[model samples]
Target: MKIKTGRRVASALGGAALALGITLGTAGTANAWTADWETVDDGHGVGIYNGPSSTSGKHGFHDLYTPDEVYLICWIRGEDIANQGNVWYRTSEVYYYRIGSYNLWGNYYVYGAYVDNYYAFHHRLDECKS
Candidate 1:
């Protein structure tokens, strides 16, 4: 009986240890930037905007993505622009370009509409995975 009790205690301790380890491991990853990373939808193009609004200028990067482009969406802001209530996603990728004589590369915003539109889609980096 003593031996059986000892084995049961050891098994319980092992199970507890495993649960704690899994909880800690997942907690660490929960804080990772990849947790905020989202993929762009297939066949849709998003644009990196100069600002959260659709009226904001488009940076010169102009690289349209086909699909599954991973981007870190730091936050979202609500703005009334482009005749629709827009949810803009702020990202980490920098948009590079030159304005006449000056060169610049910086992070930009993209409108959600661009991500949903069928044609003329500009993959800016705002659309989140569905």
Candidate 2:
């Protein structure tokens, strides 16, 4: 009878240890947020600016992307600018800056306008359904 009681206690302790191990293994893992992309409107090439507005300095390297070009939309913000209230989409692509006369590529902001009169961006909610 004592042997059976000892075996049951050992088994319970082993199960508890296994559960604790599993919890600790997954504790450090995190889920990062991913974004979608949008294309430029027809006949209107979008400029990947250095900041959120047109007045906020331009990146001097790449030319304007054509209407066929697509860009990743990471986030959206609304602010009053360019004599009107505008909503801007923060793109995933980084813009470069010029230091005096040299161009340096680093992490920079590129915002695209989401005007109601133009189809500047598009996304399918069905794609996120899994």
Sequence-dependent TM-score of model 2: 0.40
TM-score of decoy 1: 0.42
Task: Compute the lDDT for candidate 1.
Answer: 0.41
Best-matching candidate per TM-score: 1
Model 1 agreement with the true structure over 1-130: per-residue lDDT tens digits: 7544543454344335434543211111111222233435546466666667656777644533443232333335556565655566554342121222221224455555444441112333224332
Which lDDT tens digits does candidate 2 get at residues 1-130?
A: 7544543454344335434432212221111123333334444345555555677666546533332232233334434455443545443232121222222222233444432222332332111110
Residue 33's lDDT within candidate 2 is 26
Error of 1 at 86 (Å): 1.8
Clashes of 2: 0
Query: Model 1 residue 60 lDDT?
Result: 48
TM-score of each: 0.42, 0.40
